[model samples]
Target: MPQSNTPVRDRLEEILARLDARRDRERAYVKLYTESARAEADAADRRRQGGATLGPLDGKVVSIKDLFDVAGEPTLAGSIIRRNAPPATKDALVVKRLRDAGAVILGKTHMTEFAFTAVGLNPHYPVPGNATDENLIPGGSSSGAGVSAVEDTCDIAIGSDTGGSIRIPAALNGIVGFKPTASRIPLDGAFPLSPSLDSVGPLARTVTDCMLADAVMAGDPMASVVARPIAGLRIGVPQGRLLNDLAPEIAKAFADSLDRLARAGARIIDCRIDDLMERLWGATRIGSIAGLEASRIHADWLSDDAALADERVKGPLRRRLAVPDEAVAALLETRRALAVEMDERLSPYDLLALPTTPIAAVPIASVETDANEYDRVEGLLLRNCQVANQFDLTAITLPMPGQTRPAGLMLMGRNGADRMVMEAALSLEALLRNS
Candidate 1:
């Protein structure tokens, strides 16, 4: 059992002080469980004094995305529409797991309404500003989770990534985000963006922190993860669509990361998987499983005459309703076939690396004012990460080294190969930090 010299109550008080100082400016938390967290920390302190600790995360404060149920609270999913919804009778399975492991719940964080867009602008709640620059948009859906982690308000922030939500915010905020295979963690009470793609994961300061949170969520024993050496590791870089149209800063950071890995004796291969890319893109264009499922989830709410939901969410759902059943069936088939082909193509390599986002964080004012720019930037941000979700793969975004603006180097692996991706990320993280 690992122990911290700092008392849990003391740590919680320190975090509360920081939260108090920044609350008006950051707007990171939607609901602060200050009273409950204090109680938990005092309990942890008693256990510590008795020489008994819960686990690795005992006394650690963590934030949950508003998408998850928290017993008596109405799971907001960052929407005013859900304000009248009934309270959850029990904790979400993931929340219960975290509590059982001795993690203090620090309250829910804000997100894009229904986790709809890649750009994290909430018309209802105050949108959390980017951790690096207040002017920039904090990457979507998991916006507050990333902000909270980056701001040191919590040890970990649990968020759901359906289409780059977790990784996007993490990248823009210069922290580590991991999206595990959908099945690795149960989604019993998580509000769905796309049941097919929604995955519960963590955004944290280090790869090891993510691994610990992931283990607790997955109901697995926390195990020491040894980093796989970068030497002799086969890493592939997709050449065509993924690498196209990279912003100068993003390109430079990505290229520099590749150079470091190559110098470390890793085999960096230029892979051309245009057919798979085409298939994936086709499915996205035709109709998303996310959009289809979202339509179904909100059908009753959308049916009301009053404008209850945001247009950004309503517009997509309305479009999804027009999509024929045949089109959805065809898209599912295409998605399945492409997943198989993509796995086979990537089997030879330990991981595939790409620029997490083609562009860096855009100014919040720019996107909020210009709808066209918002659409273009949102599509680009979700482009690379969408492939991993559609292909049912595990992926991670690691912050690149020595850049004025934060950029991320993404490593994606096969569906069940989460540990492999984490190990590789650990090694890569070391390289980035040392460089």
Candidate 2:
């Protein structure tokens, strides 16, 4: 394994120090489980000092989503509904993988309730402020995961993306966020919101960090992705409606990104995706499979105290229950058809590129309380990302260079094309930086 000159303790301590500085009223973590984290890090350093080194992530700290099972820690899933649920009997599969790789578990990060809403707003717990601007909403469900990664609270922050939860926050917060093909990373012990679309991935400072985290979560040995130039890449962009709603700043950044890639010898093709809105609706319609499953898991709690749940959360969940069986079946069929079409359309190129979100981060306070605005902004926030989940594709959102407000350039690929997607992403990363 490659070794670093920096001491493990010093590196881990630097990340933890940033976490300490973030202590405040609007912090996301309700209970950090800091004692357990410190113990794990200390043990890792001691093992290293004793000349018994382990995996590549020997002392790296990763933040777990509140939804994952951490031995002896309650799996809140970002709601009070399961507050009384018993402590997890064991760490979830991903957690086990992290442990096996010698990564220190740095406690839980807050998220949208039941991981449903894209906007990162939870009335019950403090919302983590977007790193770039305190006033901006950390595009979420996986809100804190992105913030923690960007703020250096952890080397990697794990999150589940159903409809852009992972990519959204990463875009707003200015970091690399990846949503692998749903089955690429196991979700055995994580809470489910949309079974069909739900996928576990990470938000990190660099694509290299995401690569490392991806390997650990998948129970594979760590490996490095040698950065390649963007020369000869066939980059596709869906024109018309998909690119219509972007803000002026996002449009400029995207155009600049294209110019850089083209200069690097990439062929930028204007691709058109028909029935995109229908596909988006179908994906969202089928998304209720999770709510149905989750509702079953929380049936007792919902019946016993539905009123105690966050009102905003109840709206999304209740809507799922109201969806007719026939409608769901129809949506499932639509999903199958769309998936087939996506594969045919995307197979010709190595990857497709677009603006990650139609707009940049919205004001945090407004997102927290205004349901109508939240729905609109959240839809816009997730528009581009939903396409990947809709067709079961893998995608990465890289923060484009330049621009103070923060925006992302999305690179997408067919389902199960994770390695190819990563290769394209690393190439684009270099192109954007050197441009």
Taking all chains together, each candidate's TM-score versus the true structure is: 0.97, 0.92
Candidate 2 off by > 4 Å: 1-3, 14-26, 50-52, 276-306
Q: How many residue pairs clash (N, CA or C atoms closer than 3 angstroms) in each of the candidate models, in the order given?
A: 0, 0
Give per-residue lDDT, candidate 2, residue 322: 57
Q: Name the candidate that leads on TM-score.
A: 1
Per-residue lDDT tens digits for candidate 2, residues 1-435, read 124655666666666676677566637565576777777778887888788767767788888788999878678899886788898989999988887778888878889888877878887787777878878888788988888888777788999998899999999999999999998999898988777778999899888788878878877655566665678888888887779878999999999999888887989998888575566464665445546545545555554443677766665566566566676667767777878888898877878999999898888878666778878997798778888887889999999988778899999988888877777787777677777
Instruction: Give each model's whole-structure lDDT.
Output: 0.89, 0.80
lDDT for model 1 comes to 0.89
Error of 2 at 33 (Å): 2.8
State residue 317's C-alpha deviation in candidate 2, in Å: 1.9
Which pairs in model 2 have colliding backbones? none
